[model samples]
Target: MSTEPTASGHEAASPAVDPPAWLQRIKSNYCRVCGSPLKLLKPDGEREWRHVCGSCGYVDYHNPKLVVGCIVEHEGKILLCRRAIEPCRGLWTLPAGFMELNESTAAGAARETWEEANAAVKVLAPYAHWDIPVIGQAYILFRAALAPPYTFSSGSESLEVALFAPESIPFDQLAFSSVSITLRLYLEDLRAGTFRLHHGVIDKRPGSQPNDPGAFVVRDHMALELGGASATAAGPGVQEQ
Candidate 1:
């Protein structure tokens, strides 16, 4: 789509940190493909350790999960849902969820919007792509508009749903940094009359040292030149769910 300056800014890399507990649990557990115990091994020319099955030779690739969402705007208000699940219960966030297999990212975004808000939206172009290595989730966000009628209800995953004006967004109580960042950029673009694709990384490694990097950093994709690194990198750990 549009290539305008983003209000949310870019994320930068910092000192490497420890993985999350959920990922550690998966690494210590047995293989899912087979009932065999997993062992750490450097496969072929790889630098880091990988979980390999002793009996079945299954290799567990710790990849970032794909999460899809939509920025559903009706009139001038944006839709937000109060999370009913753990990790961030009762917190407000955009309509988003883990992407299922056999579905396109756009379709998944639309599905999540409908599931979380019970609202129909016309899925538009991809808007923001966030690489959340600490949580092992790569978020693909789409820019969408509310379809006709603009009625909405809270789905099972949401405790409640409502539309909020840009100036009234609850930034302090957002469920995730990605959601906050996306909304900020969207609001800024709305004011500037331009919307651009945003790419950035968010690291949420727990117990990080103070002198270490902050929880969030956004890179200037327009100014910096990436040699050839994939936007989504394989982080140190993996999460089962």
Candidate 2:
């Protein structure tokens, strides 16, 4: 497996196909809502094990986390941030982060763009959606254009921020497979002059064969029907219709 130096300057291994053993152990042993030990139980009509709290009978259901990001375009170049944090530090990626409470996905995408790249953008159409079951994450990516002034700086989460032409994007140094795939699809659509919504699954769980050194396996790719009206621009940190 290929490895890269993280922000701490320690060589980190590629993303695992399976959740780390520690995570599984932690999930199996406790209930977050109630201070109680948990036991595995299969509810009626369910085949999977669920953590059940013996004290409050609370079923701890683990769901995928929502991650939002944007492909911000300016003067025919795309924005990317060099991560200052771990997981894939020093590598480049689209401005993205986990969703927070009381915010729409598009709002979260725009916020992350500003937070990571210090660049304001007019959030546009949904560019991509991905389900990564193994890591328990769903990524919502949007196509956005740089708002007036077109200025940017690196935020605390980034070591540097810069723009690169589509042909100059460093695919090999991308922080995540989702970012790489999104950029590739965006560039392809840009050439075709038709940006459509892309939906897919990335299963990196064990027993699966990864297409690349990183355990990411992209599957179930297809264009989706845009069901709603076109997206509109909204003010910074505001949700769009």
How high is each candidate's TM-score? 0.76, 0.78
Give the Å error, residue 205, model 1.
4.3
Clashes of each: 6, 0
> Once superposed on the true structure, which residue ranges of model 1 sit more than 4 Å away at CA?
1-25, 205-214, 220-241
In angstroms, how far off is 63's CA in candidate 1? 0.7
Model 1 scores a TM of: 0.76
Q: What is the lDDT, from 0 to 100, of the residue 30 in candidate 2?
A: 72
lDDT of 1 at 80: 94
- Kindly list the per-residue Cα lDDT of model 2 for residues 171-236, writing each as its tens digit: 888888788888888777666555668999876756443224567667878875443333222212
Which 10 residues in a row give candidate 2 its minimum summed lDDT? Answer: 229-238
Q: Output the number of the lDDT-best candidate.
A: 2
